[model samples]
Target: MEGVAAHQKRKVMVVADPTRESAAALEYALSHAILETDTIILLHVENPNAWKNPIGSLFKWPSLPSSSKVASSPSSEGLGNGAASLGYAGGGGGGEMEFLEALKRACEIAQPKSSVQTERVAIMDGKDKAPIILSHCATLGIDLLIVGQKRTLSNAILGHKRSGSLRGLDTAEYLIENSKCTCVGVQRKGQNAGYILNTKTQKNFWLLA
Candidate 1:
């Protein structure tokens, strides 16, 4: 037990979105961070602009319900050309409900006995979401914040097709710089390379997983 850590209960918040990077973050947290005594908060910082701009990129997941206002499949082809198609008019803040649910299922599967909380915070106007996340961390007394890092090659190849108006990639790096709690940025480097992580103390630190 020389190198083992003492048991502690903490709130771990992972930003849940419809991107593979977000999924990778959650997967990393479950495998490396969360404990049975720790609570997991699946946070979704919704960018209203994703729905407002017809061409802005938003997530589409297979697990999403067919009637979901957001993308239900991994294709931008379904976005159409209006806010109505994206359900931007305001139904019940259920825009990302299904997507969050999928993340919840992943947490449950990873830690069956762990307590989990979920929330969706909307970014108002053109304000940056990093401050919103910090506010939530303060209010929730979070101990750790895990954000997903998008691959650079993917961005160069996919261009705006992946990021669009959401700018989630920027949000992740911002949290690493400004989060009050212990924040971590995760990027999957495939099965062989394990992972590349970013933290307040380390930049692009490679972990063997």
Candidate 2:
């Protein structure tokens, strides 16, 4: 009975990057959605350009093994030791490393560090960020996925672009529309005010902070 109950907790995956937008998504998850029993997965994707050298880049993190599912509550001690083992091997990945660490700090600030168990995953970005992210979500059986989004001028007026534009497919937009699980695109409203949320069924839904 204990094992079955433990396996039922929700799994929340928040895409983490150094951008202000990414921070807002993390903030939204921590503030409004997460619960005490939730397991947080912080996923950081590194652009190919950011790597410079694929073989030696410190940004490369091991991919999730094929057999893993989203377990209910991973051990806090194990998470700590695993993170410590993933130290940078001296390269140009400092900035990316700092990004995930900052997001983790946000997690800790929201919930007592001892109570919130978290996992960190860094992946090398492929041609399209959304598809790779979607694949991982499926692999992990994530319950909720959150990614930060900035409302572009075009999107604000025409909804989101239907196809790849000069800037390519909007990752957050694609995820919100297509991810298998419930996916949220959170946009912070300036430096204050509140937030604008986009989901599969809603667009520009405002939530006053």
Per-residue alpha-carbon lDDT of candidate 2 for residues 128-202, written as tens digits (9 for 90 to 100): 677778888998889899999987974567676465332554889888777889999998886556789888777
Give me the overall lDDT of model 1.
0.67
lDDT of 1 at 84: 28
Give the TM-score of each candidate: 0.68, 0.67
TM-score of predicted model 2? Answer: 0.67
Off by over 4 Å in 2: 1-8, 51-97, 113-126, 161-168
Would you list the C-alpha lDDT of every candidate in the order shown?
0.67, 0.63
* Decoy 1 TM-score against native: 0.68
- The stretch of ten residues in a row with the least summed lDDT in candidate 1 is 61-70
lDDT of 1 by residue, 47-113 (tens): 7767555332354422222232223334324444212233332222555335566567545645767
In model 2, the Cα lDDT at residue 170 comes to: 82
Runs in model 1 deviating more than 4 A are 1-7, 52-97, 153-169
**What is the lDDT for 171 in model 1?**
75
